[model samples]
Target: MIKKITIFLLLVALAAAAGYGYVTKQVEQYIAQPLNIEQEQIFTLKSGTGFNRVLSQLTEKGIIVGSDFSKLVRRFHPELTQLKAGTYLLEPNTTLAQTLELLKSGKEHQFAITFVEGSTFKEWRQALETAEYLEHEMSGLSEAEIAQKLGLEHDKLEGLMLAETYHYTFGTSDLDILKRASSKLQAILDEQWQQRQEDLPLKTPYEALILASIIEKETAVEEERERVASVFVNRLNKRMRLQTDPTVIYGMGDKYDGNIRKKDLRTPTPYNTYTIFGLPPTPIAMPGEASIAAALNPEASNYLYFVASGKGGHVFSKSLAEHNRAVRAYLKQLRSNQ
Candidate 1:
């Protein structure tokens, strides 16, 4: 009877060990199972969401098969129990273990919005309005109202924000992006202004920003920014009219029909550099850091004029006669192309 009882106990122990091994193998297979997706999928985990809810969501979306044994995965791998909330990208052929690892790592997917250099405030507004997954708080607000909300001292929003690609998580507000851009622009302007070259005609950092906006509009070539800045600086020193077409266009506002006639240049609006004699009352467009730097420290040159070369960039000149010659050449090139 004692031997029989001992054998019964030993058989029960072996059965228990076999059950444990079977459960472990099942969990391993569960972890190795690929997600039920053929393409990339965006998953959003809201704040205060629990691990069980995440699993339920995956199960509901048919991304994974439901199983009571799958929950035991967390018991084995304790790190999988802590799921961070944010937007995540689950790629095709990603295993269950890989997906859980990504969720636990808290690396949320990022979306990018770019505010292009030389774009006007109106264009920026349109861009913000159209950005995907971004919350639009500034939609119905006036420019002045938006400025006030951003804690700006003045209503002039032009050139206040920096031009660059800003990355954000899902549901980020347009105002939040604007605040970041404005803060970054202010910080960079302050630092650059402090290190500016001596004898610059710019009386304040705002003036430099205004000039930078004009320079940004004048040229798209990276290397030509300093030279373009030099032309404007020289014009400022000589008390000559800037006569830039972009300023005239800005002054025209919605009235500008893509063509600048003699009347538009002769128009006496505040932003029309042909008539204003000094810097515009406000910046014409957003300027990048390089443009701001070029405005503060222009290339040492006597150039006071520049015109489109009709091929790509602009041709710089020291005198009006030289500029007229360049303009004639540009027209000739245009005619030849036609």
Candidate 2:
């Protein structure tokens, strides 16, 4: 009877071992199973979400199956329980193990927003308002108010932010983006200013920014920026009025209707370079690093004038007579095109 009892106990232990081995194999297969998705999709995991809840949701959405095994597998891998909350981009054919690895790794999907060179602060603000998944906090605020929030001593916010593609995660605020861009711009400006060429007419980095904004608006040609900067710098050294049309448009503000009349050029405003003897009080638009660099270190040239070539780029001139001829040529071309 004792011998019979010992044999029964051995049989029971063998059965238990087999069952345990089968369960372990099933859990491993479940972990290796691919998610049920054919294309890429965004998955937002909110704060304070638990692992079990995430698994259940995935199961309900048919993104994954066999949550029971996943829960059972989690008992051995305690690290899987520590899931981070953020927006995730789940790709097709990703296995359950990889998905769990991503969730626990805390590497969330990044979104991008671009601020183009020569765009005004108003345009940047509008872009921020339209950006997806970004928290808007600067809506309906005046430029001065927004500047104050960014800790800017100057009331004007123009040209303070850098023009570049900024990457951010979910729940990033508009103010935070502005702050980062502003900080980046300041750092670049400081670095450039420290390495600037000697004897530049610009008294401060702000003056360089002002001139850079003009250079940005003057030409879109990559090669023409330094030459354009030279013209402005020469004009500044000679105390010649800038007489640029963009400044007139900026000064006219809402009054400008795409055409710059002779009367508009003669009208005196703080931003009207034709009337103002010095640099404008603020930058007219955002300037990229290239323009900023051009402002600080201009090409050596005696050219003082430029006009649109009416084909592409501009015809630079060293004298007013040459500039007038170029202007007439541009008009003739314009008339021919019409």
Question: For each candidate, what is the lDDT?
Answer: 0.92, 0.91
Quote model 1's TM-score: 0.93
Q: How do the residues 28-71 of candidate 2 rate in per-residue lDDT, one tens digit apiece?
A: 88878899999987788889988878888888888988645777
State TM-scores per candidate: 0.93, 0.89
Top lDDT: which candidate number?
1
Tens digit of lDDT per residue, candidate 1, span 8-106? 999999999999899989988887889999998889998898887888899999998877787788787777878898898899989988999999999
Question: Pick by TM-score: which candidate is best?
Answer: 1
RMSD of each: 1.9, 2.5
Model 1 residue runs over 4 Å out of place are none
